[model samples]
Target: MRIYLDNAATTPLNREVFLAMEPYFFENFGNPSSAHHHGRGAKVAIAQARGIIADLLNASPDNIVFTSGGSEADNTAILSGIRSNGIKLAITSAFEHHAVLHTLQALEKNGEIRIVYLQHDAQGNLSLPHLEKLLSTNERAFVSVMHGNNEIGNLNDIEAIAQVCKRYQAVFHSDTVQSMGQYRYDTRRLNADFLVGSAHKFHGPKGIGFLYRNAGQALYPLIYGGAQEQKQRAGTENVTGIVGLAKALEISYRNQEVTRQHLLRLKERLIFKLRDRIADVDFNGNSANTGQSLNSVLSVSVPDPNTGISLISYLDQHQISVSGGSACNSHSGAASHVLSALDTPFGRATVRFSFSRYNTAEEIDYAVEKLAKCYAKPGVSAYAEGLLL
Candidate 1:
């Protein structure tokens, strides 16, 4: 039985999304910028897709700007928000993905942006008091925090944070890539200046995502070229990818409750099975406060350090796909910054099993069974000790 438990990394493209994108690749291959019939048809499709995305986020189509993916969307928001507003201080958490972390680091090194790192509590929630203190010190700042952490699946109090930003008159941006399809976000209610999401994370095709910029907030374009994306972003659009994203978003929104409940059930089942069958296993994220998190991701750590990598390998060998950390940082063999920020034991064995609507209870059972066997292997404990030594 093959089980895919890495939906947080990327989900398989839904058939509906694929079908929606089919005609764009061959039948309607006109640039949206063209005024001809073919161009007009493509433009209509693009507009419709934008409308669909807008409806999903409860925003006007004019507020959405498509990009290559979440990384580009993040870069655009961070660079543009700071540059346009001339805000020297950027407040973000140390747990952010490399996309945000590295971007802020580069800007700081260049003396283009000053950054303040927000502290995370033991549960991975942002420390509001710390954030308020930082904001009080620097009145002119842009705060960027993620909606849901990709590794641990910890959800931040974005609404509260937005209120803090409002009090401080700072621009607030959120990387909602992980929570876009999983959670309900009404842009009007969230009150964030900028939000970013990637298509691939929501069972859509790769190479496309969008940044929702609230009206009246200007951002400098990272990619300068032909006027595309209403001058806020440039370069030719990914027609097929955009269509796929819209279809995916439509499905997600239409079936949000059903999918959310299904994923939560699977997550609970998996956690129960792990706890009932395995020893020395601890859940890493705020499982008790799941209402604030994406119920699909379950980050767990084994007390035995050596078993971490071996367990991942064993799961792979058993055709049960999981993640040691974010796929972007998996190759580096580094401990997760998210976990580290929460003061989770570093250099310990950890695995994140993220679910999707398509996952089933049977698959969870099989994964737990395989994990139990792997953890019980002879010398596995010794191997774990060696790593610490």
Candidate 2:
């Protein structure tokens, strides 16, 4: 009875995706770069996958470039866009994941780019006025913002941000890995110059992701090798992974509306149960009034001075899976930057529970009951403190 509620970190691979990739592993294994029939078969699979992904994003197939994963896609967008466009500054929010933050920081330290961190409101909403001020101050720069936050589940107003970027004539990029399969995405409406996503975030295989480079924008290559991905990313393609990605995206898109409705219901149920059962538990993202949060993720903070890691361990022992923060940095033992941005006083107790289509309401109820019991135990608090210290 192990319940998995950490879909934001990575989803369980779908059976359909795994089945689609089986043949490519042995029977049809071929390097897409080679010239024989086996190679042609792999090339055709890659092309079909690219087309499917392009259709999902509402962009032409030519606009998409395959990468190793989301991190590589982020690096290609920020570092390559800055290098190619000669933009010396990058504007991003304080709540960005480390993939974007670390890349920007490294560039800043190398004296190649100036990084400006935008402040957010207490509800995790970006300040449009502050964004305008920064953009106006730096007329030409590269901007990277995520479509939906990985930890707190707050979705940014990409349309408003894009309008500001248009006014300033700056390059805009978004990390769409968390939002892509969960919501409907239209590149034209987003009006972003660069976008990134990973397959593993949406029930696809790992080690594969894509970057959407708007037409007419050129990005410098991160790796140099034989020309592939239109010479933008040069490496041998991961044929099986790419095939699995396409199948996953296709199934996700076909079921998007149904999945969204199911997740929204689960979110409502979880929120209600937590409020009824837990004391002094506060949500860290936008309230229900703002209409800006994603239904797939729900973050809660307990007021007790207990470490989330301890709660995570208790949940694990009870056969429940959840996360304290972004899985990418869970081991670091540092405060979540997203919670800090929201000015949450109980940031140390924050725990994120994200859902997917496979999640059930029974599991949610069990998790809430277990959490309430854990919080009421005085010994649990002491144990949590010991581990933190």
10 residues in a row with least lDDT, candidate 1: 380-389
Candidate 1 has what TM-score?
0.94
Residue-level lDDT of model 2, residues 329-377, one tens digit each, is 7888887777777777733477789999999999999999888775555
Clashing pairs in 2: none
Query: Which residue pairs show collisions in model 1?
Result: 306-384
lDDT score, candidate 2, position 343: 74
CA error at residue 121 for candidate 1, angstroms:
1.9
Question: Can you write out model 1's per-residue Cα lDDT over 72-145, one digit (the tens) per residue?
Answer: 99998888888889888999988787889999899999999888888776787779999999989765899999
